[model samples]
Target: MRLETEMKMLQAKSQAGIVKEETVGNASRFIDVSAKHTKLPHFQDGKDDLDIWLTRFERFAESNSWSRDKWSSSLCALLTGRALGCFWRLSSEQAQDYDKVKLALMNRYDLTEDGYRRMFRS
Candidate 1:
């Protein structure tokens, strides 16, 4: 009975995830990112606010049922100019290596100058 209960719970969780996916667009690339001025699905430039960009980017990634690799790859492809340049000469294709891309972006853009100081001091 305990085993059966656990199985049912797992099934329920999976079903819920499916339902959520449907709501977020189970099809290809949730929003027409190319059509938008931001060029990143629901994201906006917002004076290069990484917080706002990350939030929208995450939602976009999730909606398209992307993995970490896919998330990094897609974002890398869409980013251009200074935003794209920060990847240390790595292009969208090379930056598909999720961990490396994520680390570089977060270290440079996500963290404030003070945050970096605190990180090193700690």
Candidate 2:
């Protein structure tokens, strides 16, 4: 009965244009409704370099003309393993800020300013 009422409320919200409705292609699957859907390359730890991946993502975002406000959410979709975990560890507000999130990811992977300097020196 409670679930039914919640479903009805959700349906009403969808009808009223308060919530966007997403089409399901197959069996019902979870989707991150808050994110604006876009295809982005996933970040893999160990196998891939974070700095290179970040550069590629920035170029891709610029090429697509994606707004800075949408970058954090869109980028969240592609995070995995330690990177995803790094994102999760941030406070909700920090998670919404792309620069903060990026810094957190870089720090987690030992890509700090000193680390970059070491790389350059090497």
Best by TM-score: 2
lDDT, model 2, position 37:
42
| 1-120 per-residue lDDT for model 1 (tens digits) | 997896576556555443221234554222332343334643334455665677788777677566675677677666655556666576656676866766676666647678768868
Candidate maximizing lDDT: 2
Give one digit per residue, the lDDT tens place, for model 2 in 1-122. Answer: 99789777777776654555566885332333335546666898788899899988988888766678778898889989999999999999999999999999999998998988998999
Model 2 Cα displacement at 19 (Å)? 19
On a 0 to 100 scale, what is the lDDT of residue 20 in model 1? 23
Model 2 stretches with alpha carbons more than 4 Å out: 1-38, 120-122
Q: What clash count does candidate 1 reach?
A: 0
Model 2 C-alpha lDDT versus the unseen true structure: 0.81
True-vs-predicted CA distance for residue 30, candidate 1, Å: 17
Model 2 worst lDDT window (10 residues): 27-36
